[model samples]
Target: MWSNLPFDLLANIFSFLSPDSLACAKSSCRHWHQCARCLATPESPRRHPPWFVALPNRSRGLFCCAYNPIDDSSSSSWYMLPLDFLPIPTRPVSATAGLILLRSTSTTPFQLAICNPFTRQFRHLPTLNVTRINPAVGVIELDPGHQFGELNFRAYVAGGMSEAPGGGALDEPKVEMYDSRCDTWKVIGSMPVEFAVRLTVWTPSESVYSNGILYWMTSARAYSVMGFEIATNSWRELSVPVADRLEFAALVQRNGKLTLLGGKCGGDACIWELGEGDVWRMIEKVPFELGMRFLGGKGCWDGTKCVGNNGIVCLYKDLGSGMLVWREVADEGRWEWFWIDGCCSIRGQQPQNFQIKGLLLHPNLAHSSLLNA
Candidate 1:
């Protein structure tokens, strides 16, 4: 019956399916698989489940873990990703779709690589000319209407200090962007000294890219969320809510909007969204139940962190409190919490004993073989 349908009709049918359901449909038949690809447009608004990249306690490799709060607790949902996919001690600096931007090590003169954990396809990126003091990587989909696994993407490396004679605070910071089309990197623009100084002093966590802008928070800048526009190569900074004594904060893309999750030690936290003209609008309050629970019976809240994607957000305290996640329901006004215990436990573990890096990602079928095209 699927074979009889016109191509346009089949594309429309597959468009409404979730990412996992679409993957299942593609496996039904060759015709259905082709239809799935045709419908996987960049503009397609279909959402995928959020998966946490759990750092293993035993090995240097990472684990892709997902927990369904609605599912029975007895079943196992975490999958240990193969270590052979990338070099040892590879740090995933950024993630989009299924592709994660990795560096060989957390150290200087970073060797860049891109790999899709789902497909286990790995590809190396060009080496940077300068080692960033506290560098961050940002990725943008260049092809206006491309699909999930397509290689039409560009990577921008910004806010890193350079290695050169007379390297000082006055040294201007430049943006290096890699274009997949040319397969080369170029210096785009130099940011103002104030921004460069912050980058030098404080290395931000992995940045969140939405639309054409890359956003990250800086403690040195009073916890301001900095935005870098890829097209114009410009910078904009937005102040976060409750900046005083913010122990932890994260910027993530939810429902295609740039969202901020800020948490304080005194049981204060809230999620905010970028409103018109770069305004930070509070969307949802971090429920007191979750905050109080994170406090772990203590009267005051400790440090906390926010990690998530695809409308699901996880909050975990620094002192080994279990993870509390909020998953948004479609067309529903309420949000509920999901308990993800394995990944959140690493907060209390020794840094060398357990490495915890997470990205809320949707599995993508795109492969490195497409890069040959």
Candidate 2:
């Protein structure tokens, strides 16, 4: 009878399972697989809140150390998810929804793959049409189609320089796009040369995808955001607030809205919601004591990390400092901030050993066709 349970009841039961347990259930029987797959549409509610995953490159096999903000400093819990199943040395290029986009380090021109580490389901995408380093990577995961009912997404590499025709300098600025449904890449178009140079040289691969637009913060002196609209294959830029005064800045999609987080040198950290007409309005700011503590002894937010989605945003300052987690409650129109313990589980020989990347992801239990092997 348990196996023959009604579809509604079974889906309710499936919703209670954690991601790992859900994976086991999907593999246990054909009936369960069918049951689980039916419940995996984009409309399904996620089981857990967003978690901060501090991904550090490791040689003795890959392990994911994640921090759940709700656990509080007293518990200081960290979840370790092994990534040994993946066959290559790869860097996480971008993360959206339940999928992580990875770039392989083993190949001449880096290879790209999108995977759900929780389910151990992975798929490698075709080689990119553009060859460049450190380009702005973006991803947009859409709701399943009415016909196929399969979840789909797009992975984009924008504003990267290409080797010159004469093979002189890495000068051509172009955008490459990959569609998960087709598993292919296309050279979308060339980027404005100014943005391409900035992107190819050093923009953070972490990006914000919202409303079919992908956003990346530039490293230029006047810090502007490079945005790409997938539908039109068009490029645009948004200038950040107090660009010169701020020592730290990042773009985040908070609760389906565009947000800006930054702190000035020897000043308070701010959270701004991007308003219509390309304006920014303040939503919150760090409490003075908290901002000072987060800035560490250097007394500035230099090299800080701001990442989140779906109403949760996290801020991290280096030098072994803990993270500041912010949450917005929609029904109440309220917001709160708190501090959680840092990633102490990741061990290394000082800071010289590895590249540590961070992203805020809501751990999902349901099946994603995009990640299904």
Candidate 3:
């Protein structure tokens, strides 16, 4: 039966299967495995790799951790990636375009790291001349369409330092750009608003890159979003409709538009899509009962719109069950809840190693199989 199907057609069919399914298909028969491998290659027209989320396990005093959700039911496993290799006090701030950005929490000079789990290749970014005293770092791919070889991939680090007690500037915040191509760093510009030391004072939220500019949200005890042009190195503040102060929010790309997921203080979640002229319009809001209570005010916006892989948006939830669960946004504004059992522990303790720290879906690995086949 397999012999009758054209090779190209079979390869295309395998592309839609999940990573686990792709592995099973390979074991089904030599022909199927070969086709499956070919379809998984980065060069393949229909390639989708497994997605990963980083969750810190402060229990062991280790600032680094993550979890990878496997589709396999029988043997669900989560792996651990430690930051012991890097300097101390490093925490993951963002993941974009196949790279994870980890920043140091130490007051001593620190550096940022752009790591690729699949390749196990990491580039330690040079320290910015600008000091980041409690700053937020935002990362994004400069050109998603351009291959790593064709265009330079960059991550934009932004945020300001806490202010002094006497109503004076304690630390000036600045934005810096890291160029993967040159293996160098450059200061772009400083943040427009002066930041106060108060924890209640919202510093810059996560920044999202779109159309050569990066956007971030500034509460300022008032509500507003700002845009920074990487090329021109200029800052522009924009107004966003005032909403309840969210403890955790993220900037994500959906269908090529920049979207915001705001988690309010009361465990409510709302989705805002960037409309014409970069206006933010609220699209969907999670009802209070939809396991939103677990969000604990933190969520990651993955550019997925499907049930299985892409368009998966996760909000951290602390279910009364005493376990850390994730509320997954499903198709048509539906919500599904899944528990990461034995996955989380409080500071200074390590949870069971069932969770995966970092996961890389290499479409390129699929291509290697095609060559051998």
Please tell me which predicted candidate would have the highest TM-score against the true structure: 2
Instruction: Using lDDT as the measure, name the better of candidate 2 and candidate 3.
Output: 2
Q: Estimate each model's TM-score.
A: 0.75, 0.79, 0.64
Candidate 2: stretches off by over 4 Å: 1-42, 57-60, 69-76, 144-151, 318-320, 345-355, 364-373
lDDT of 2: 0.70
Cα lDDT of model 1 overall? 0.64
- Which order, best to worst by TM-score? 2, 1, 3
Q: What C-alpha lDDT do the candidate models reach, one value each?
A: 0.64, 0.70, 0.50
Note each model's CA RMSD in angstroms: 6.8, 6.2, 8.8
lDDT tens digits by residue: candidate 3, 1-373: 2354455446755876789888898899988878786763334332232444443422133323333343312223334455444444455555555455666555444466555543344455666776555555556555553332222367666665544568655555566777765766787776655532321146433456666677666666555666777778777766655444665455655555676766555445677887887688997776555433343323422211111113444443321112222333434455444544434443445544432233222212122111111
Instruction: Give the best candidate by lDDT.
Output: 2
lDDT for each residue of candidate 2 in 1-373, tens digit (9 for 90 to 100): 2543445435646766789999999999898888777764435555345667767643225666666554544434566677887877788776655567788777656578766766666767877776765567888776622222233677788765556787755755777878777878888877778777777775877788777788888868777888888788778889888889988898888778888998888888888888788788998888887676666656778878777776788887542457787877546777788777665543332222234577766553445565554
320: Cα error in model 2, Å: 5.2
lDDT of candidate 1 at residue 129, scale 0 to 100? 60
How should the candidates be ordered by lDDT, best one leading? 2, 1, 3
